[model samples]
Target: MKKKRKSLFWKFLDGVEKVGNRMPHPVTIFAILCVIVAVVSHITALTGTTVTYQGVDPKTFKAGEVTVKAVSLLNPEGIRYIFTSAVTNFTSFAPLGTVLVAMLGVGVAEETGLISTSLRKLVLSTPKTLITIVVVFAGVMSNIASDAGYVVLVPLGAIIFASVGRHPIAGLAAAFAGVSGGFSANLMIGTIDPLLAGISTEAAHLFRSDVSVTATSNLYFMIVSTFVITALGAFVTEKIVEPRLGEYKGSHTEIVEDITSDEKRGLKYALIAMILFIIGMVLLTAPANAILRDPKTGDILGHSPFMNSIVLIIALFFLVPGVAYGIGAETIKSDKDIVNGMSKAMSTMGSYLVLAFVASQFVAYFSYTKLGTIIAVKGADALEAAGLKGITLILMFVLLTAFINLFMGSASAKWAIMAPIFVPMFMQAGFAPEFTQVAYRIGDSTTNIISPLMNYFAVIVAFASKYDEDSGIGTLISTMVPYSIIFLIGWSILLIIWYFAGWPIGPGAQIFL
Candidate 1:
């Protein structure tokens, strides 16, 4: 009877998965949600109803009158507002701007064949016992180049596993787990560091009139988290995901190729260039009187040129090394070739641009209607009303954020809508913004692999299709669901443990009141 019940449950889940697979892309779904929100907001305005909800302020709640004006979707005024807001929001859209700019240099790396060669060398040299660790580490480190992991490492993982006579899907799963699932944890800081820090700073200001969280506030913790996640990922891949995959008998066989002389030379040049770049950066920031150091405090991270100009610094880090590799490898013969590479990279961003535009507009409309604030305020009020305190409250917030993440994938956008209410509300309840932000990160990241609303979910499905022509959204989601569940449970447990241990979330940032 129990076995029968389990079978029935799986059948029901399969049905739900099929239906979800047929749904629209996350961006389109969110766009539709935006229209619904707009229409409802308009009706609320017409009714002259008072909308009240909990906000960042636990004591005082967000209260507003719904007011909407009928404006033609095609009219100049309406179009102007939409377009203007969309552009403004897009400019501030954390991932888009950071990824695009970062790619300028990363394109050079890939165009020069540095990244490809490096990946090949790593895979070829690593032993079978350490393959999972290598794959996970590569995935974690790939964030340095933004989308490079999804575009390069994920496919490479499959190829590597196939070469080793392991299941390619298992390799893909392991790599994907690291790249997307463990995105928030990395040894080195990436463009997201500053983006999230800026948002946290803005939210923190609600409580403290003149407070700011530096981009590297969480740097030390994240560096430690990288190894922890990599180890955990390796364990999961070997013990669970790989075992579930069973064996590799795919129609498309793996091809094992020797590393070419040109590739080796290119990698050598890239390494040299990277070393030089690192040395230069260290010199610029190391000394007490170094230019990159903070002028007043002489701190490297708090208020330094290195952190302030990190975007440009990252751009140069990749560009200089990549250009050197290209020159040495003779892949880039002219400026035109370099330009073409960057152009190619930009071409891939077309879908993201569309998604960003729609997402931005929706977010703007939601904010305009004052609905997000109201929802956040009301939610916070209920939690406060329940008298939940301490670690329990943090865990509750983590679960709440995770649930919300299922429907809303964009971290910054969700935080934009959530932080104003949760941050201040939690602060009033004796919790800090840093703690709330940390909890949100844990929730946001663990579900990214399974969230259909995630922009890259389609891309992942497409990747899966390369192996199994019959693969669809259902296949991809089912394959990844286990990872999502494991990550959520494991990550939440870690957060709870950290909270109880009273660990600092960041530099001068506390996990407690």
Candidate 2:
């Protein structure tokens, strides 16, 4: 008897999954990376490899040429830093606090049946023709509330898809594509906008002290991108990913339907609570003397407490609605249910916590070694020396950024390092800082879905594992590759078109210097 052989595509995917699964857990990989960083720093430092670039002197606040050299972590000072900074590193890891805090509220919503009910209602009510678009668009818009999208929408997409008898993993991929792949594209300004803009401002200051980059610098393009990503995500999910997935035959078949009268009442109460919450937020930020606004400047966007506390605000929005729904439905009879919900959410994060601790150390050590900065500077210098102009140069820069994004997970951190070099260089070549910044953003966002080093990658695998017990990082990445590739091509073409048409990428942000 002859056995059937697998095709090349499946063989390749199998190879990827086998290889990825055979590797150590992400925590162990990070620990290994930390050791590797230490060893590489010694080798580089011993070789006296160095790179110098124009940068702002942190202490002096003046533009000057700064030389970076790899510092070995095998030394006494390095050993001291490793020991003393361990606790701080873990504590300071940004995603840790954000995910944990956000989950505290989401925990209540999920446990009290609010989230499930809401998602079910949304899916059931949406038109069949628009289901894919709605799911993808919701995922894109969810970025406005920060990491809540990852914790809530990704799984919700799966549930919704499965309810409709579609492939759950396909739905998960679509949502993940929009949430992570379209992270930088939103109709509204997100925390990431101001954070990245602040870093861009700092980098731009290296060339011109008076240069400023605002949160809205990328607004118009991002708004257009919101649609671009939504359309692409929906198209890919329907035409490519879903077809590949076919029918889901997994054991997890729980679907929410036929909503009970109590659940209906609960949803009404939740909606009212959410409305009130929004009204409260409006009152806080809509007035000149509002508490959440900037005390000194009376601004809501820049250096404002309102922007800083958006996460907490979102948590309250969720918490309030969950409690309201619970009260209406009598599902949560006591505080113990609320406490249990929060505890359950935290329990699921056990693996994430371990990964975060190790990842934090690796990130800190990499920064300490100055390798990322050197690599970024070197890359930027190479691109600058290429002497290309117009669309050719712009496209090259975008490609370079996309390539670099594979290694660095933090967009702000990577931009902070690259912008000082590229912003100045592009300006010298008669391109606006905003133009270069947008190019970087397109690259940064497109690669996030494919990058295993991304902070949320492990979390995503955990989410997918709920449906397919064998789903691993490779499975997730393979599912996401279509989105990543399409997004990259589509976004890059959009940028080129915007460039050729001589349009403003944002308010007062021109394509040329």
Candidate 3:
């Protein structure tokens, strides 16, 4: 009877999961919320009641106009405005361009068989315990290449783990955890560092006009967070996720493939090339007088040649080793082969391109409606009005971020909107921008693993299907929900502790007002 009852409970949960998974994506949900806000704003405009919190008021505070203007979808005026804005805000919205350009070099490297051979050799040599750590580590490191880790290492992690008789989902979870959850945390700064720093600087200026947050502001904290997330990910996989999965008596058999001699040679060449590249970078950046150092400040963190050219640095680092491996392994005899490799890498991004386009449109519309700002401002006002402070403020921010995360999956986009409101508001409440950013990150990351609107959510579901053909979005969500809840709780607690300690969130980044 107990066994039957347990089965019925799972069945019920499965039904609930299916219903939830089939709902509109977070962005679409946000669009719906946008409509609601528009209606409310219209009503407020008619009622002549002003909503004011703190001193700063929204542009819509007076709410005068409430008419549906016949806006042309292809208005020449709108087109001109967009073009002008794009040029003006080029750096502010340039991640896509930066990622694409970097990928050109990365494409050549990945195509030439360098990444594959190196990953295979590394996985083969490492012990089971060490393999988990290395996979997680590699996942973290892959952030340097942006989306490369998601397409390459995540599946490879599953393949490698399954080969060793471990549950493949556990490995996928570990890698995903490191890749997405550990996103803000890495040993080195990437494109995100600068992008987020710019946003932070802009937000901070609202409160302290003279203050500027550098790209490396969060570097120290991120470095520490990388390891903390890695350890937590491994533990969750081994203790929680894996045990729940039990032994893999599944139908799929592990394939045993040996590394070819040519591949081994290519691996050696790639390693040598990587070592040389690293040494060169160090030599160039190590001395204050080195050309890579900032001409004025002699620092690598601010306006440094090396920092400005980090994308090019990454391209060269990957390109050189990849070409060397391709030649050594006989994967690339001519230019055509290298081109083919890059093409193959790009082929995998088709889905992402579609997702990004839709997401970008939604983000653009949300910005146009001015709904995000209004909500953020109102939220900040409410928090301040409630007398929330310290850990209470941090937790409130986390929960608020998490809730917003459900309707807005893009971290950068969400932060772009939220930071302007929250950072200044929190600063007024005696919290620093760094502290607010950190709290927002915790909330943003914890929900990523479970949010259906996450672009990769579909991909993860497909990955899960490999284990169980019947697996759907429902199955994947059910499996990952535990991690989301646990991570939120655990990470929130850690933030509270970090808050009480009053430690610097990162280099030159403070925790308090």
Candidate 4:
């Protein structure tokens, strides 16, 4: 018997996984980058490197010529600043507190069993014909609790399909596609929203010191994308992935368990609590002299008390319903349960805290050295020279991010590096920081299902192996390629439409500067 041969495409993908897997941890990578910045800054400063841009004059604070030059972090002043600012950098990093606060509420919801029960009810209640769509949609929505979707919904999808005598791997593919590939598209602003917005704001500081990117910056776009990803995910699963997967042959059986009576009672309590909360918000923001509105401007979304309160509102949004559900379900007999939930959530941040510390230093160094602004000017100049302006420039950036995502997984880590260069570059090319962030997200999300570097990619493979028994990276990637391809193409087309239409991507977030 002759051994089987693999195609060039599979070989290429295999090589990609191997190379990505060999890379150092993201924190170590950032640490290496910090040193590189110090050395590069020294060289650039010695060479008297500078770029003059037509923008606000730094000294005069007027719209005029601005010249920027690299500053060496290895110098005495720079070294002292770095040593002194390390703690400040870590503490003042915007995303750090945003994530920590948001997770507290989400952690309560998860610990109270509200999120899991809600998902189970949603998926189980679907009609037989709509199982695929429901599973995928639930997977998309499950992002509210971070990694819960991968750990819960993906396997539950397999169990659901197996119960219906369908191919379990197909179900797994659909769920994985939605959970990972549709990560950036959610009906609600998730932990990632404020997290990325903070980084974008830091990056935007390169061009304009007063700029602030809000968590709702991409809210409208995210709303549209949720349905887009859901439709695309379901379509690919039924039309392409399911057909390829065929019928299940292995003897695997599992039951689709529905939410219990206690869980049902808890859900109802959560719903009532949520409705009342919304009513309260409307009363606060809908009146002409609303308390949450700007005191003089009568505006809610602009420079108002409401806009600034978004992070707090988000925390309470989950906390309110979460506490209600806990009481109804008898999960939280006292306040200690809530405290425990919050602590558990913070415990998960051990790795993120480390990564954020190093990344904050890296971002600080980049800003202190003026490399970010100089590069932005240079990159924008080059793009202008190449006629890659407007739509073309944005499209090309989406492609570049998508390609880079295959080798690097952590979205925050990648954005922390890319934003310092690209966000300001896009702003210089006449795009808003929010819009640039949106394009980056479209690319980052669509490639996640196929990327071997995605943190949950191995977990997905493990789910698949439970059904197929012989499944590996190739098995999972091949199953997900259709989703990744269609999702990228379809989502890009939607973004193009948004660009040409010039619609506001979110609250106060226009595509152009």
- Candidate 4 residue lDDT tens string, 306-367: 76776567778888999999999899999999999889977866756777788777767877
For model 4, give the 10-residue run with minimal summed lDDT: 56-65
Residue pairs with colliding backbones in model 4 are none
The stretch of ten residues in a row with the least summed lDDT in candidate 2 is: 1-10
Q: Residue 141 of candidate 4: its Cα lDDT?
A: 91
* Candidate 1 residue-wise lDDT, 121-168, digit = tens: 766788779998988888888876555577557866876777677887
TM agreement with the true structure for every prediction: 0.70, 0.91, 0.70, 0.62
Q: What lDDT does each candidate get?
A: 0.69, 0.82, 0.66, 0.78
lDDT of 3 by residue, 120-173 (tens): 566677776787887777777877766566655676677677777788877787
Off by over 4 Å in 1: 1-17, 25-31, 43-80, 83-93, 137-176, 183-228, 235-254, 287-315, 347-368, 406-440, 450-480, 495-513
Displacement of the residue 182 alpha carbon in candidate 3, Å? 2.2
Count clashes in each candidate, considering only residues at least 3 apart in sequence or on different chains: 8, 0, 0, 0
TM-score order of candidates, top first: 2, 1, 3, 4
